[model samples]
Target: MTEVSKITLIGHSGWGPVEEAYEERLTVSAAEVTYRYHPIKATAENVAHRWRYWTDGPALVNAFENLAAVVSTW
Candidate 1:
């Protein structure tokens, strides 16, 4: 398995933080990529759902690609 970098995706919409853990892991492919992406909501799911509206189509893919590129450079 490859190493994945954990990143916190925070935003006012709330989806960012909730999806941070999964997204970071998926993006980095690391085992223990811990992220603390939190929105105004108390539940992680709430924050994650926000991502639905915050990002659509290529936005998420583009963001993930950009993050992977930056990490590879580092």
Candidate 2:
């Protein structure tokens, strides 16, 4: 049996509309798409902190693992 490909998308809460539009265009793909939303403010400090948290958090780590698994099959 063949394994379905998967994709992960990480973005700020404010980009919901854009993300939705992008997702809509992906409807014909066989790949599974998963989204991870993070709250971020306009200030530089807030933006930096949120990005740091996202990159170091457990959820992102798992996402990387999932990505690695998919790449291994190619």
Candidate 3:
């Protein structure tokens, strides 16, 4: 059997339904999907800070590094 690839889903807290459906579809391909929800207001500064934190923070950086792809809904 082929090994499943892991992917990261990053988006706002409001995208729960969309994420759920996408995750369900990805299951057919045996993908190991994970989600990271950010509830910050939709402002340029907030978005930039969020991305910088996710990409630079030790824990998040490590987790993101292992992901095959990153799907951002922001």
Candidate 4:
């Protein structure tokens, strides 16, 4: 048998007043999760790459959840 552990990381950046606080709450709610601000030069290329790895690419054995937002739509 293999041991498995699931971790959900909610990356939050460029959030408004409301959502910004919401992210904080999520961080507190999670028992063991990582949270951080994306780098200034995190462009689309890096975003896709990170997402793929975070979700375990080419395996379909792991799962991930993304909570991204656009200021224009908020």
Score every model by TM-score: 0.28, 0.28, 0.20, 0.19
Off by over 4 Å in 3: 1-55, 69-74
Better of 2 and 4 by lDDT: 2
Write one digit per residue (lDDT tens) for candidate 3, span 1-74.
Answer: 33324443333333544323221112111222333333334343333222112233455544544442332222
Model 4 TM-score, 2 decimals = 0.19
Give per-residue lDDT, candidate 2, residue 8: 38
- Model 2 residue 15 CA deviation (Å) reads 27
Better of 1 and 3 by TM-score: 1
Q: How does candidate 1 score on lDDT? A: 0.41
Tell me the deviation in Å of residue 62 in model 4: 18
Question: Could you tell me the lDDT of residue 25 within candidate 4?
Answer: 16
lDDT of 4: 0.32
Q: Go through the candidates in order and give each one's C-alpha lDDT.
A: 0.41, 0.37, 0.32, 0.32
Worst 10 residues of 1 by lDDT: 23-32
- Which candidate, 1 or 3, has the higher lDDT? 1
Model 4, runs deviating above 4 Å: 8-30, 42-74
Model 2 RMSD, rounded to 1 decimal: 10.9
Residue-level lDDT tens digits of model 1 in 1-74:
34434444433442445433332111122222233434344454544322222334565556666676676566
Kindly give the stretch of ten consecutive residues in candidate 4 with the minimal lDDT sum. 63-72
